[model samples]
Target: MKLFKSIIYICLITISLCSVAMIYGETRQSQWIDKFIDSFELTNSNFKFYNIKANMMIEKDIDMNELQNICLLIAQNLTNNKDEVCLKTEKSQVYVNYNDKNTGISIVGIKKNAKESYIIVDILNNKVYKNIENIYTKLENELSEYSNDVDINVCIAGEYTKKLKKAKISDILQKILYNMYAEKISDIEEENFLSVNAYSKLLKENNLKYLDREINLNIGIRYSEDDDKTMIYIATPIIKIDY
Candidate 1:
């Protein structure tokens, strides 16, 4: 009986040590995520994430299926772990929770453009003005030709700036993605929609006050050499807004 009791005590000690070790490991991961977020100069209001998880409010009328696909694509493309992607929708915004296994990065997607369209990005851990400036510089260099035709506006929302100072990451990822889309789509055939002509036609058809609101255009293309078929999904946020 004495020997059995001694063995049980030793097992209990072993379990306690294992539990402590596990907790420490989780704490370390959380800290790494927090640090990465802080590096982006994030604030509490513009974005808030705890334990690298966040909850957002999305409208009930929003398309959850399309949001999920985009979220999944982002996770697959940017993060090391695909299994970490989790999503839930509320009345106003869809909440996405995922850990950057490589960097403990947290991200959220807000505001859908169309059925499966959303603006999203990793929550920066610190102020992103420098990063934003870098992007702007790159845009200026790349868009030299369009400088005459296009007026580039770099407006940083006050709230976003405040959040950056507080080390809360916001949705700059969406902006970066949009910039990338712009670059890629511009290289595609000019005959596609969203050429200057298309924009003019859309504006005329809708009788829109184009100056009042910003327009976001997305053109998705998938080409199959076997069938000689190209599938294109062009999404214009302004058009959706008018509808």
Candidate 2:
């Protein structure tokens, strides 16, 4: 099922961005992040944080000029930099870059086609920020002025350098899934990678179908040969970002 890399680009544009696939309410969105952090702690307390990403998709068409303006606004608001917000255009995407050292925020506006376009605001940080929820809520409210409907997807991820057997990784995955009260839908284990797709009622997030089965939680364990470290990622309503 290509669990590790399910998202693919077409025509130099991401036609099916994972951001639009996952759904969660603004009020309860933090539930998934909390659960993920809890799961990571439970499985291995030494798991160092990788990043926390939040994606917002505006479900309406926008012109390039307007998209650029929105991207700039988002960037300024995120980094509180009104001076000069760097924006770059590549193929069908316009990107806004932030210049913070500890926390990094990026906003991109993608033009899928003439009749369809969307803006994706992604907030990435190496360490967990206390005001992440507030930032998301504020951004959602600001974006609402442009489009009435906005879809939000969040993924909290971490990693650790420890070589463990497949059985041990499976046990960790099982503990995480069980803690979330998730029902396993499918799982794939390769020589160096293991992934599980499941659905958890406690998450309160929307689910997407995979191979005719409903799944809303995705857990992956991978062993890196170069660094010789194991990486584990947990996301509710399916992980939108590539591991």
Candidate 3:
């Protein structure tokens, strides 16, 4: 049964990209960010992650100077150490870079374009010299402060490649399957089929407890050499991400 569940989860990971389209009310970029965060959150309590790049475009151009100041302020709020954040101006861009020497986590912000503007941030997960809250999450919260004006079109590419681990995938799969099963049974109401949640509820009545955890997932986009159309893969490789 465990092997079967593991196989099912692998398939689900491969197919999840397509299945996610049915989900409404969230932008693809935001969903992608959520998945990025979820992968780390599931494995460790305080694992830090870095970003490759994200787009933070506003409806109209805001003052570039003001925006750079905001980035500096956000960095200050996250740290007590002075000189941790250094500011610099390059052609058509202003940068705010943070170096957390204690934890080796660097959060960087970029404001681009001369007349119009947008923000690109890279969350670099340098070696975990110490435990710290994830940098992307902090910067994400900072972005929310300007939500009224900015049209967030953040997308990221992996700078650090990861090796997928099957054991980790299988462990997280149990939770994903249980949650999905619960949702299915609640809406469809099959006559003979009982959801894992429903069965767990029955066990709870008899003083036994069965509970499920949530899995953070994103759809895998697979391109095929044989076919022109790209495919969705739910059974994704479990990977260890590092710089």
Candidate 4:
């Protein structure tokens, strides 16, 4: 009877140990989930977005602590202000948002093993998608070759009309300056220096006798060094001839 009591005591002790182990496992899982949710909220509120979805998967045998760390790393790696987006993670799910038409959410998934991990992002309604796609098509047509060094997947997604206008203006100014240098004639008379003969000659050469509209020509010159070569910078303004 004492042996029987001893066996019962051992069984009860084993059961109590098993129950404690189960509770500890549950608590760990709950804590891991809670941490992911909290971190997601903290990170997601900064950006505007339409929608977001994330799926994170880890091997069943992976430690909860390790899983949490991996999730955090994924979040850190994918979130950025240039995208104008925010992300939220709840357990294995992620959510994202962008403020308006200029921005949109992206969903990223992570899968990991002891040897390696993979990250996949689904940029749904992402502003860069069409731009990147167009760039890729153009690149393919131009190069007929693929380069790993070039990131064709990246794009600038924004309203760039103003930027384009500035660029065009800069190009036109450059062309105008180039033309002026090519056409410049030396020995221009200064406005302050009155050369009676040269001034009369200039007016006569320009056919000012029958001019019906006002004509004004202002010219100036400066010097600079470019690529170890002396460069002459010239400015000229020409107006219509007047009687």
- Shift of residue 20 alpha carbon in model 2, Å: 28
* Better by TM-score, candidate 4 or 3: 3
lDDT to native, each model: 0.36, 0.69, 0.40, 0.32
Model 3 misses residue 38 by how many Å? 9.2
Model 2, span 163-182: residue lDDT tens:
78868876887898878888
Ranking by TM-score: 2, 3, 1, 4
Most accurate candidate by TM-score? 2
lDDT sort, best first: 2, 3, 1, 4
Candidate 1 stretches greater than 4 Å from native: 1-62, 100-104, 111-117, 123-243
Clashes of 2: 0
Regions of candidate 3 where Cα sits further than 4 Å from its true position: 1-54, 102-115, 125-138, 148-171, 176-216, 219-243
Candidate 2 lDDT at 41 equals 74
Candidate 2 TM-score, C-alpha based: 0.72
Q: Which residue ranges in model 4 land beyond 4 Å of their true spot? A: 44-243
> TM-score of every model?
0.25, 0.72, 0.41, 0.22
Local accuracy of candidate 4 as per-residue lDDT tens digits, 18-134 = 999989765653443343223223322221111122222333444434444443443334334534556565554344443455544343333244533323333333333223333
lDDT assessment of candidate 4: 0.32
Residues 58-167, model 1: lDDT tens digits: 33344656555655564454445677767677653556655542233334555554432333333322243334433333333333321222223222221222112111
RMSD of each: 22.0, 14.0, 19.8, 29.5
